[model samples]
Target: MSYLSRSRSVYGPTTSTTCLNKDDEDDDDGGGKTDNNNNNNADDHPGASMKQRTRIGTWNVLTLAQQGKLIQLANEARRMKLEILGLSEVRWLNFGEHRIPSGQILQYSGLRGENAPRHRGVGFLLSAQAHSALMKTRVRNLTIIQTYAPKFSLSYDAADLQDKENFYSQLNATVDRIPKGDIMICMGDFNAKIGSDNSNYERFMGRHDLGEMSENGELFAEFCGNNDMVIGGSLFPHRRVYKVTWVSRNSFTEYKIDHICISRKWKRCLLDVRNKRSADIASDHHLIIGEIRLRVARIPRQEERVGRQFNTRRLDDTTVKRSFTVELQTCAADIPEGGSVEDQWTAIKNAFNVTSENNLEERRGAKGAIQRSKTRGAIYSARQRYSALEKKVKRSCRRDKRAWADSLADEGEKVAATGDIRLLYHISRRLSGAKINATMPVKDAIGQLLTDPTDQLKRWFEHFEQFFQVPARPPSPRYDPPRVSEPIRVVAGVRQGCILSPLLFLIVIVEILVGAIDREPNRGLL
Candidate 1:
């Protein structure tokens, strides 16, 4: 099977569904490489090759009219075997109604608030397979939105300063919401350049610095620099194709306006950026596709820690003196009969072992440095684990409240029917701070509690949700009589007995009559 088909089969739609034609399927099963299959084998089977690399890409599909071209791009990306694809300038109507031409499943978001596209909206499309791989480690909190404020004012006057501030504020807010360590690709026609050649980008933008730094593009560049972000397809060092996204909607002026930026944490993962000539003409904006190798450094659990002795002593003069004495004997072996004064000095220097003593001290310093690094790593790891556990615990507590509430309701119905509503009410009041007793119906109280979960319970539930990673919604309590209590009354003159007990009584009577007969054997009329 071809690599693509194999990947699709292993992680794609079910094998039962055949989107490909019969001929296509034949070609797929025949030509599809087994590399992906081998990857699966490594996971499920033994002695399999490990996945050491992953490739990611990004693209801006021009317009909805070029849907066919978009699909072709997606196919090309798939052909390139991209695990993650970050797409920009994808317009989606209200309530997410647009369909991607590429069959590749997409996780997208609609434009923020109305004012969609703002002129042009930006969206992201990640390969379903890539998402799955990421989900294994951490869930992706991808944010896709469009931001555009006409930078080029009709008048020669510069754009409003507030506009730039507002843009940065919105951008920062959006970025803040994204979970840390998540692979995020923020890309679009930012309508700005990050760096410049002739004029220092920073100097050109005057001292009207607000939340951000630049006037045209330098502000964005500074913001990215401070945030430790990398500009993908940077035309620095050597300019390949510099182009602008907007040019009178008809006039063509090549400018590298549209771009993609990634976090510096993913620096190693960024593999290559291919600015295809075909892609540039495909859209008004040049298509800058980036290929990133998604790699996870498999940290081998520390070798079952061997207990090592910690020594505080440094290489001292005593050790150096001892080494010098040992070298003195060796120096004699090097000397011949009647050597020059220079030769004698060299022999004395060799006997002193000065270089070896210095080398020993440096080695000790290096060891100390290594120890400190390991200690810091351990501390950091511990802190992260603690934070994760704390979050989990909080979530668990929240879930427990609902569970505890349900239990109380079940037990409450029984007590309520037995005129024990007060007892259940006290329990609810104690646990969830909701009172349900003779004065209040259980259903009404439960509704109120769910509607307004107290801070304590809310916190508990949040933690509960975090840990269990499940919705913790309790069912509304209903007064079911069967689950409660009922009065009981016995009917009069009704003998309820089995034959064994009744027969035993009769046997006792016969035995008594026989005993009486024994006392008077001839008494036939008893």
Candidate 2:
């Protein structure tokens, strides 16, 4: 084949793998997320045990071209506690890793070039922990290759056939290149229903699958059989609700199109594969998470810093203030008066949280996670209500953020008139968004800049290790000192963050001075 033929995709050069449109493309009315009964699903635990398991999932978002969708999707991923999420129909141009503000890494492959039309794309959004695992995969070598395949069709269209062939052929080549020893996980929106019948293809899939085998299923089964990848989802038996990944926008009909498969050698490593309906990105498809039993290195958090506080300026509004006050009063009423300091603090924090959640972000429930029940009538009404609520919330948030900036600007102007340089500079920096990265990266032994967070942490650990090393001295008396008694447990009179802590400290110092003067009058103690 000529380079030109291989370079361009079936849907032209704009999109390489997935077709631009499919009947299963959208859920315009959206779908219900956050089902209460889904708590009993496998992989519900947060994998906080010695046997560190990683949660990897695949999703068909249809299109991520819209605003705020990616952030909402990321939040959903965090709530689902997924380590890695493969995405389809991302519709983002170019191929690269984009580290979002949330510290998650989004590594995507889309149409190449600046002018490439944003169409079908495949990508992986990795949590900080998951990215750390991928970086340290030498200890646990694992490779994941995801794809976005065209849907099955009735007509024998040449273009459609070409698209399907392109996906399978590319996938086959990619699978062939992987080492036999490495665990290979192949997942994505195949759009192929393998059905519940395990006839002839028992080795590749399980009989627990949903729906009837379609034309595309035959090809997918053949592909997995050739590759020796056992379908992870089918291997585990679960209710049909857990298995269903795609539902019609109307919330009536359902199908299982997305899949997660593991190479035969590591089939036992796949503990569970299920759909998380709660992770709604307003798409027809649900997030399919697979629990792979691998000891992943826990990614250490970055240096502790105060997180962004809420824009409290909104409380200045009378209606908002009144609502917040009422909610706070109700929440406070629920708290007991007598408790330990820690318990009381926690209660107060909860009270604040409840009030803020109620009044501050009023539009928060409008997003994809708008308390869905999955019924037809519920989903329809929810979608319509969400559509209207979403706009209102977005506009309200934008206005509030803008007002905060304006208030900062106004404060800066007043401070300028008062000649408070520090206040003016602080306000200016806050309003300008702090474009410059101020954190200085660490250096390796060779003095190369360690830009990756993991590498930087490693370098810092090495530095600290060498810095605290015991220095060799001339052989002095080798007598070991006698063990000292346990130190006294000291507690301060005033608690930290108390307004009168400094005042109480001064009072204590005054008492010491008074006692010293009374005991030994001016014995050069001054």
For model 1, what is the alpha-carbon lDDT of residue 513?
83
In model 1, which regions exceed 4 Å deviation?
A: 1-55, 65-73, 79-82, 95-102, 111-119, 131-134, 138-160, 179-185, 198-214, 235-239, 242-252, 280-282, 296-526
lDDT per residue, candidate 2, 1-526, as tens digits?
0000001222211111110100110121112222222223223432221143456789999887775677777877776767667888888775555667787866666787779888888877776555443332223346676678887789999988888888788778766755676667888888899999988888778888898998788888989999999988889999988999987756678999999998887787788898887665667888898876543444355546442245476698999999899889888998998989999999999889777866665444543343445576767777677677767645765776788888988898899999999888888887886623233325589864344567778888998999999988879787955566844344586556668867887999999988988899868465
Q: What does candidate 1's lDDT look like per residue over 1-526, in tens digits?
A: 0011101101001101001100111111123223343334335423223223444444555443232344555655555555445444445432221234443544333345555442234333444333222212211222222333235333435346666666676677656755574555555556564434423433212221112223456656765666667665452233333223332222223445555566766544454454543332134454455543322222123334332222213334587556545666666666665779998877666544543444343333332332234465654554445445435434645665678778878887788788876686776675664322211111122332121124336755666677888676899898755533654433333454544656666887999988887888777645
Cα lDDT of model 1 overall? 0.43
TM-score of each: 0.39, 0.62
Clash pairs of candidate 2?
A: none
lDDT (CA) per prediction:
0.43, 0.68
